[model samples]
Target chain A: MKMKYYSEAHEWIMIKDNEATIGISEYAAEELGDITYVELPIEEDDVTVGDTIGVIESVKAASDVYSPIGGTVTEVNAELEDNPGLINESAEKEGWICKLANIDVAEIGDMMTPDAYVKYLKSLD
Target chain B: MSDLEIKNTPLAECHKLAGAKMVDFSGWNMPVQYSDGILAEHKHTREKVGLFDICHMGEFRISGKAALEALDTIFARPVFNQRVGLCRYNFLLNKAGKVMDDLIVYRLAEEDFFIVVNAGTRAADSEMIQSQLPEDVVFEDVSDLTAKLDLQGPLAADILAKAGLKIADLPNYFNWTEAVINDIPVLLSRTGYTGELGFELYFDADKAADMWNYLLSFDGIKPIGLGARDTLRLECGYALYGHELTEDYTPLDAGYAPMLKLDDFPEREFTGKAALKALPVENKLIAITLEGRRAARAGADVLDASGTKIGIVTSGAFAPSLGAAIAMAYIESGKSLDIGDEVQLSAGRSTITGKISDLPFYKEGTVRKKL
Candidate 1:
């Protein structure tokens, strides 16, 4: 039940056992405005740490969503196809983009904790 | 580049105070979105009300007996027959049948006229018009001295009437009238780009701040930024000058053939009309809606079932009202694509399925209500 860490790119990983749930932070969603589309990585797609795994497009612009920990995409949220606005309504909750199974915990050290992420977001301003 | 000299409108400070996300738009420091966000602002305009600062647009005044004839020769649309207090949408074309700029002409009097041009194309439009006018015609660029504010929505008239102006007495759609709002002389026009019941207010730029504050003091009125303005217009199938109506695009290719009176007007007498008639249109503008949430953008290629590139998108975005991605593009004519025809849009890494749809992606609008 412990949330692991966050990335400066605005991705958050919630680790439970060897599986990790990933989605953008609320801060990122707010800045990006209305989410029009989410291009999630395919299942069983291998992703390395810091590698781009997906894309999020808003009315204004498109941004790449990066992987915080190296692993293979296990499941992608299919609801995004019809309800992209869910990302804006619940970025870190039901709007979770994908799940990564068999993730390498060693890569978590490279990410920041929730408290550090708050400070990291402030540094951007 | 000296930060590109972000010119400010009179409502620049007001936008900042409203927590708008400011961006540089063609050298003008303008708000792109507000704290309520582009979606909210767009929805407000569609369902209720939204106010916009359009002062950055350029305005010009022309007078004299020769002015009417000079304008008729300069624009692709007829101007001399336009009655006083009425406005007509027209385009300035190059000799090659390409559009130089799309503008609205307001016939102020028998010989005087006011031209409202796009903000980005002001200098070029003014220079082109001036160069084309006869020596006897008097032309003056009045952009710097004028300010424009567009109040648009279903409640626009009620809001204006509450502001001490009797909007009921104003002219009908595509018409204008002179009135005083709180002792401030203003030119009110029942014209807007959002496809909503709206009014465009023209007054002295020096008094813009006062008028802006006075309008905002009312309940349910909010300042909308350029972001919402664009989305609303796109939903209505209105073309953005630089994006859709460019110097390289002709009126025929942009779905303006109905407006062209080629048979009766004669191509030789009008600027660019001959070239337009000669250059057989290779493509036509069409509206498309994606099957899913993934939106196609400008520069995205339109492909046929065989993967052959057929066209390119001019403007695209996620339509808040429609809850889907919509776009406008020019596709090869005679492609057998009709309403409900399936197509594919290639956005680099992925291709999205789309269907040909009618313009004005959003259908629920109160733009042309009968008084």
Candidate 2:
């Protein structure tokens, strides 16, 4: 089963075996309003925990996407180049920003689980 | 304004019920966008119709026999020639020839006029005008008692008909007429910030919710928030109050030389007339369009090809209508830049390449459509 983890910064990472897919959480997507442009990380680029992997510009403001766990960027979502609204439609699935490989699986233990993330979101209110 | 607490419009409850996301705008809690988002709301206004709650804007009624000559001597525009039922966009300049506010003057009758000013500059505008006007003239700030709504789009007329509102004669462009909507008296103007066929309606604040709900109940009309309002105005190259018109810059810098009527009415006298005549034109406002959706927002440094700063962006946005980013910047006067000239703007951690375009980035607006 794929294990989903969420960071305090509102990024979500879905891990299956040793590979993980990362994207912004639905809450973050809604807060940003409409996504206009995104600058993604390059494939084969190594990123550390809390490193800004990309930049997302919305209609209202610009935000940086940070990696919660260290890994190598195996692939970037090419579909977002023309249609960034996919992030607003389905931020967790088809809107996944990037794929990570060669990651330290133990680093994700500090992140929140799906249920824990739900409880954490409630606390924000 | 008496307390530190933020103020809410009379239609606040209605906006919340419509799933609006609220934001603090000039000390008032206003909707930034509804559930449809800015892009969708923007396109809807362009294609269909959108309703905007603009009650936070300030309204002042100036009357008396001396009002006409007094106003003619107050604003940059030649108000003496402004006919009744006509609306004129004018500038309120400080003694230093800088813009205190950009307002609209509506001549209700001979010696009777209504002035609409920006919400943020309401208090200052009131103080300035009150200080300048003769004591015999009557000046009353009726902002609290008034609620303003803008019904904008190509289909705005159809929506007005659908709502069962009647006008003896539809006001011409930049003209206003008194009408009744849902048994409430209103002053309807055929004008808007968006480059679309629209109307601005002013009515009693007590009936704000009723008017908002009654108009939005129509099929084609949807409630648009301030987010789409900003993009819509920017796309049409309209100068926003705080962004494009500020105390730091003179009206001449914002490209209102003709309104000054320095040559047309050389003998005309106003508060800043002498300073405006003496002040050298230092900057010129130019429109720039980017290649993509990344916006070079206000305060971004505009640079030349060699990376030397030449100007600063005043207002910008990712225009939903054009599907690209556009900006208005004030470059140094006599830069010798022509249309289609390439330039650069500074963004976060990078520089965006742009080109000098015409005044309006979007051209197919229906604002001047004939009835």
Candidate 3:
């Protein structure tokens, strides 16, 4: 229920008090139907914007989920390791991939707001 | 990827109205699934009946005085003496003994043959077959002119019967017969990609949309798409073109050497006979059933318990019927794996452990069921 920021690659990030949580947008999850596996990043691992953090394999294809903001990895959704379908069920809430600390809020300008992303998704069609 | 033009099938409009998710499959715009989703569609095909549009597959007509001889010489399997009504699973091989494509040879008559091949390899297979045939052979690429539909599952026959198809006159397994459904002539064959009692109907491309709509009108017949089609075939341990049978691998590597039938037909000489006999089979295809919900996808590295790489996964999917993830891999020849031997697949950053299972991860398919 936080204002979500979406990336052009279809990943969404929710920031609160310098802590950023990230997951793939609903658009991305629906496109990649039946997520069979998700490779989550490790805790304490360093990540930067545009870094390839993990891979998500769906029924159709395997894709790299990129990090939208620069920060230190604090936690990964371990539930995804056993049940990646959680992402398909609830992409925005329980399906959050990872949480990042020490976030560079300046990068938010490069990302799209919820309304802007809605327009962005339509342009893709 | 968008630079290449995507082609639509004759039934594309029907799929659009049915709310199907269209994807570019081998240059043809095809539906990956309808609104029912893959799991529901897959289960429906097992319990009820599901219809699939397979117009993307390539069909060729080869007829001549030496048609059987030309076919036998080109394919790896012995196509000669195949009965007029029976459809024989055949293969085309390169000079290097590698599999070019796996096809079905439908003997319409003594000298006339109907060959069905993969969409991506259609042009290449035509060229290869043409090069080996004499000038008198009539070769026609009917892919553009033909459309195919597969009606599968336990209730397929009943549904087709209700739709005005002569169920009693239907061909036996791997056999073909000319029939009419909704007044449209079709070459009906009791064969399907799904491991179910099914019928593959072929007719004019222009009638595809009409036939598709007509089939849907029957009770318990839902439209299935490629997503369920892939999982259904995988559960049945069927080899797909790009996944299991590829240009880099031979039928022997895919654990289909027994189908070569050299013991029965020792005198038959196919295109890659000498080279195939000369080459050593360095790998064997194994079916692995995972322990959990995760699937080991294609290109995933297969490693032993010690973490040493032993093979590469060719195809993997979550088998809904079995409630486990399954995969087919080409393991090293000398590495032996028992039914319970534990193996790991490097699925991205995570590794999945599984056991080497038998040919069909899911048993009880009605593929060979007699009515």
TM-score of chain A of each: 0.95, 0.97, 0.96
Which docking band does candidate 2 fall into? high
Over the stretch A12-87, how does candidate 2's per-residue lDDT look in tens digits? 9999988989999999999999999887889999999999998888888889999988999999998998898999
| Positional deviation of residue B297's Cα in model 3 after best superposition, in angstroms | 2.6
- Estimate, for each residue in B75-115, the C-alpha lDDT of model 1 and write its tens digit: 99888678999999999999998998999999999999999
Winner on TM-score between 1 and 3 is 1
Task: Return the TM-score for chain B, candidate 2.
Answer: 0.98
- Write down the lDDT that model 2 would get: 0.91
What order do candidates take by lDDT, descending? 2, 3, 1
Residues B1-371, candidate 3: write the lDDT tens digits: 46368888998999999999999898899999998778889999999999999999999999989888888899988887789999988899998878889999999998899999998899899999899998888999999999999999999889878977666777889898998888999998989999999999899999999999988997799999999999999999999999889888878888877888766887888888888788898889999999876788899999999999999999997788987789999999999899989999987667899999997877889988887
**Model 3 spans > 4 angstroms off:** A16-21, A39-55, A66-83, A97-109, B1-5
On TM-score, the leading prediction is 2
Backbone clash pairs for candidate 3 read none
Candidate 1 displacement at residue B12 in angstroms: 0.8
Chain B TM-score for the candidates in order: 0.97, 0.98, 0.98
Q: Which stretches of candidate 2 lie over 4 Å from their true place?
A: B1-3, B165-168
